[model samples]
Target: MKNALGSVDSVLLLGGRSEIGLAVVERLVRDGARRVVLAARGDAAAIGVRLKDLGAEVLVLDFDAERPETHERVVAAAAEFAGDLDVVVAAFGVLGDQAAYEADPVSAARSMAVNLGGHVSAGLFAARRLREQGHGTLVVLSSVAGVRVRRVNFVYGAAKAGLDGFAQGLGDALHGSGARVMVVRPGFVIGRMTAGMRPAPMATTPEAVADAVAGGLRAGAETVWVPGRLRAVFTVMRALPRAVWRRVPR
Candidate 1:
């Protein structure tokens, strides 16, 4: 639950090893979040150690986003561990090669299952828990690529587009339930995810995104754009003619 000043007391991060997700958790811990639950596929020892160092009661659980059937149990376990979840961050995703997706549609589908389908299940489960508790925030990590799907990475962009819409609808559904949702739209983030790739215009870092998320949470913002300027950039990009937009490079 959140304190009188709107500081969260417990947090559950779905993507335990995500750079941006960990950054956000760190900021929340600094702001007085005492209990933390990190759910990911593999080991989360380092993250647990860091959170423990910050004075948080940390719990790392094995979670497979692709296995939607297990999401309810995952949420239940997290809730049981930390009591009422103050903040649930859904940040699991994969940025697969577009060329490979074009060649092997099955791989693209698998990526979409994790990036979009998994989120749908996790978001709904978390929302139900938050609604039951009657107060909390569900942070959905969307991407600007979803705003205007480019030819360069249409598969990943399409998945994000679906996620963005779902998050918006979920937020609306939970409007009066006292459990709100915050959708984060960040333009090309330069982090472990895109390590060897070329930087895109208006590229930001995990720390920058985390800072923006922390600020948004404090302000009770529904949607936040990292670096701030990307909102304007995307507005123009969305209105561009298809012919001109298709010519833009990745």
Candidate 2:
């Protein structure tokens, strides 16, 4: 539950090892979140220890984004351990090889299953609990790439498009139930997931994204754009002519 000051008492991070996810959890922990549940595929011992150092009672639960059947169980387990979840961050995704996806379409589909499908399942499971408890927030990490698909990473962008829409619709459905959703759209993030890649023009960091999300949640914003200026940048980018848009490099 959130205190009168809006500081949460517990948090559930679905993607325990995600750079941005960890940053958000850390921010929440510092903002007075005491009980933390990290659900990831493998042992997130390092993350658990890091959260513990921050004065959070950290618990790691096994989570596989590709396995939708197990998502409900994972959510239930987290609730059992932490009582009513105050915040659930659905921050699991993959940046697959675009060229490889073109060569192997099946691989693209499989990856999208986890990238998009996993969130669908997990988001719903978390939403249900929040609805039953009648209060909570679900933070969905979307991307600017989804605002409009690019020729370069269309495969990944298309899945994000679906996810972005799903999250918005979920937010509307849960509007009056005392539960809410926050969608974060960040430009090329220069983080562990994007290591060695050339930074984009408006590239931000995990910490920047985390800060934007925290502020957004406090303001009751439905959507957040990291670095803030990217919102205006994307507004122009989304309005460009298709011919010119196609030539804009990522």
Q: After superposition, how far is residue 37 of candidate 1 from its true place, in Å?
A: 0.2
Which residue runs does candidate 2 get wrong by more than 4 Å?
Answer: none
lDDT score at residue 160, model 2, on the 0-100 scale: 96
Give each model's whole-structure lDDT: 0.93, 0.92
lDDT of 2 at 201: 89
Q: Against the true structure, what is each candidate's TM-score?
A: 0.97, 0.97
Clash pairs for candidate 1 = none
Candidate number with greatest lDDT = 1
- Scored against the true structure, residue 30 in model 1 reaches a CA lDDT of 89
lDDT tens digits, residues 1-250, model 2? 4444256899999999899999999998988889999999887777789889989998899999999999999999999999999989999999988999999999999989988999999999999999999888999999998999998999999999999999999999999998999999999999888998999988899998988988887888899998789889988988999999999976
**4: Cα error in model 1, Å:** 3.7
